[model samples]
Target: MVSSMEFLRVANWVMNQVLVKSCYGVARKIKSHSFDWGDLSYKPLQQPSSFPDIVKCDLEGRGSQTLACDFHKVLLRTRSFFPYFMLVAFEGGSIFRAFLLLCSCPILWILNYEMKLRLMIFISFCGLKVKEMENTSRAVLPKFYLENLNLEAYEVVASVGSRVFFTTMPRVMVEGFLKEYLNADAVIATELHTSGCYFTGFLSKSGLLVKHSALMDYFGDTKPDLGIGNTSLQDQLFISLCKEAYVVMNEGKVMPRNKYPKSLVFHDGRLAFLPTPSATLCMFMWLPIGLVMAIYRIFLGVFLCCKFTMALGAWCGLKLNFKDNNQKKSESDKGVLYVCTHRTLLDPIFLSSGLGRPLTAVTYSLSKVSEFIAPIRTIRLTRDRKEDGETMKRLLGEGDLVVFPEGTTCREPYLLRFSSLFAELADEIVPVAVNVHPSMFYGTTASGLKVLDPFFFFMNPSPKYDIEILEKVPRELTCAGGRSSHEVANHIQKQLGYALGFECTNLTRRDKYMMLAGNEGVVQENKGRRF
Candidate 1:
């Protein structure tokens, strides 16, 4: 009989051999199946034309032409698909699932493309809710996709009359973005098997959509006018059916914000950076230390004075830049109202810390957890114009008050339309500009639990906030000086926008929630508290 240790070693070796052989077997099976390209036979070009050839072809002149392209190769800057799978796992499933997917990176690297894709799909989609996956694909994935878009590729696609994209990814993951954002006429991709409303973590019976076969079926014997793809044999074979074919080289270039086909005003996700495998590993490694540091920082802010907290926070990787442009105020019993542009839930807390004085904050909604952990006084505002106006007036009469007139946090460099009520509340209104930078995680989410916003913000390795208190609005611009409330609000919005180098838009909280969360931005009242 073998010894226990010897038996264990033998078992491990056997398992390793089985996994390697199984993966190779799958790879062989995939290669053995050859796709029939129908009767539309065209000799493969010995050397396919590059992207510039198509650019030189002047695509705009071909008004009747249609384009067929590979989604990842032609559109994205990066070829690796790991980051997208990690996003599905983290946002659609759970963090543990994401970590498990990260741990399998070594195995993924060794396996062939087909096997690797199968493994990643299983890990990311298994046991995930269909609704949750749809939500992430709708809200979280578009931002990353837009960020990775290739400028040269987009120029060609946008010039064409009709566009069809093919991909190996599940249709549920990429369909929404491609159709809604890129205006693709159709997206042919793999379909996932579903058990009721949950993903079964396996492909449908039809299996992965073969790009060549799908393209043939889509356009029938009539060949496409233009085809764009990468250097892979599969892509090369698929595009050969077209009258004109162009191969995009994997040169690292991204589309600039100014050149974006559409503006990205609102996106919903907790991650600020792309979660590639190595980046995911680094984030997990820092999490233990990050949590401890976050608790310490919170304790300091709650117990100590703002001046002391600021001094100590700098030593622990927290940066606060404060600038005051307020003119000396006459000694009066009435308090001044500060209208600020919202960046994160912590904007009020940081402003109070910067001023080294306590101030009342008015918000549309606050979670019970956030209200309990807050360092300064907070008051909730009901949407009723009469009631909210009275609340702000009372708060201003008591002491200095801070109000975020945009009513919600916006991550992009655009300020939402300001509410005119604040302009009517006080004669002396000061506009404040607030901006935050977090290296790893975002502090706001349109769909996730609101209670975790501040915690996630503090979890960053280095978080920075810039607070600029601008000079008070001239008396002539005030509502009390014969100006309409709307005029005063618009004036303040423009002032903050100019100071922060941001654009002002008429987008409201309702528009943001509808786009991201698929709901109106209303909090249900629970036990006499609104969250």
Candidate 2:
């Protein structure tokens, strides 16, 4: 008698050969039976051209012919017993290979039985449902209860109070049911669920009800049950076993993918979510211009310092020392809407680089325009859109928004009348003062003598610069009727002058004209001798 190990080895070899032969036969039959454009004489079947006519083929009385064909297929698939015999004979025989073959019998039998059982159950249930629907005399119930049917790895979709239970339905069907029957606007699901279902909702006539989902932490929830279908029971069992094996394999492993996203409470008294990909890309694209500006500033800065150093080499140069008198030791965690005195063209860049992290600077839409060829890093406002309370509500909710209340640059370190844009963000204000010593050769005037004001190169390069950041101050003014933005602007101007060691002056005539024009004035102020 052959041993169980020997029997198993033979059975495995037979099964592999049979399966390969069957597949090849199916493929060849499909190919040979296919219709071509040239085969106009022969009538084509009503069914799809690629389908195999296996059931239609006559398997009658020529038993020898059928047997010969089977043997030929097996020979083609396995290349005959000679190769197998030669391999076993030439090599040392291993008992383990034979043991593994013997061990596979119970697994294969279980798989075969499960597949047959699932198919039988599916056919039986569907038939029963069809027959019940056909019956005319039977009282129709509002809801149908389908029980004893283990639909594992399969899905069903229907309305909550629906009579029909759509079997093995997908996102397309679910979306249609929700829009047509349920008459609802939004259907909630997970990220995966939305991606899968949103297209279905969009393509439908009812228009896409936005696909939405929320991610919740799974605590002790029951494992999700996917109803079974074409997915093999053995495959499912294997997956479960593999999952447990992975847990055991990774017994003590701990891996952290990345750090948390950074956040900042801005200087202009707004909370800012740190740079997103859109913002980061905007910042990155601005690097080229930023680099050019930085290099120009450095060269201009060194030249100015050298000139100052030489001039002061003989006389003790004004004893230049900086003291942040506004700095408070007890005032930690104070939020400020930094009302800055805009003077030199480099004021924004100077403040951004000088201030510590978590200080958000308010910039204009024009600042965003400079980033257009790159990415827009700053908060953008249209004077038109600034009045949008809804947009402002959303913007303020995000973080502190900085506003250059003056809205234009000035020659002296003085503030212009403030815009009410600041009043929308917060009540807290931190007055920042930025001063550029001995100003620049701003540009040529109409008569061609170089004017010393900073506005000429508004978007151009600044020769050199110095910026001063002060402590947080409170917002004393409210946006009440009759209270103007100018009143608040003057308040910040005086505070800035005292901090930056400069004389605070009212708006120059050119400043007034530019503000009226609603354009950033790029004009040069007349050069005057400095004491």
Of the candidates shown, which would achieve the greatest lDDT relative to the real structure?
1
Off by over 4 Å in 2: 1-335, 358-360, 365-369, 372-376, 385-396, 438-440, 443-464, 475-487, 501-531
Best by TM-score: 1
Q: What are the TM-scores, per candidate, against the unseen true structure?
A: 0.88, 0.30
Which lDDT tens digits does candidate 2 get at residues 171-274? 22233333333232333211112232121111223222221101011211322111111122322232232111100111111211121011110011000112
Indicate the TM-score of model 1: 0.88
Cα lDDT for residue 397, candidate 1? 85
lDDT tens string, model 1, 1-531? Answer: 899646544643453345323443343344345421111111223454434343444665766689999888568876677888888998878878988998887777667767777889999999888988888998889999999998778888888889999998889989999998788899999999999999999999989889999999999999999998877678888889899888776544688988787889998877787876556766776676667667766876787677677776765667899999997683458798989999998898899999899999999878888888898999988899999999888888899999999999999999999989888888888899999998888888777778877878887876899999999888889987999999999999999999999999999999999998888866543421010
lDDT of each: 0.81, 0.31
Question: Which residue pairs in model 1 clash with each other?
Answer: none
Off by over 4 Å in 1: 1-57, 330-332, 524-531
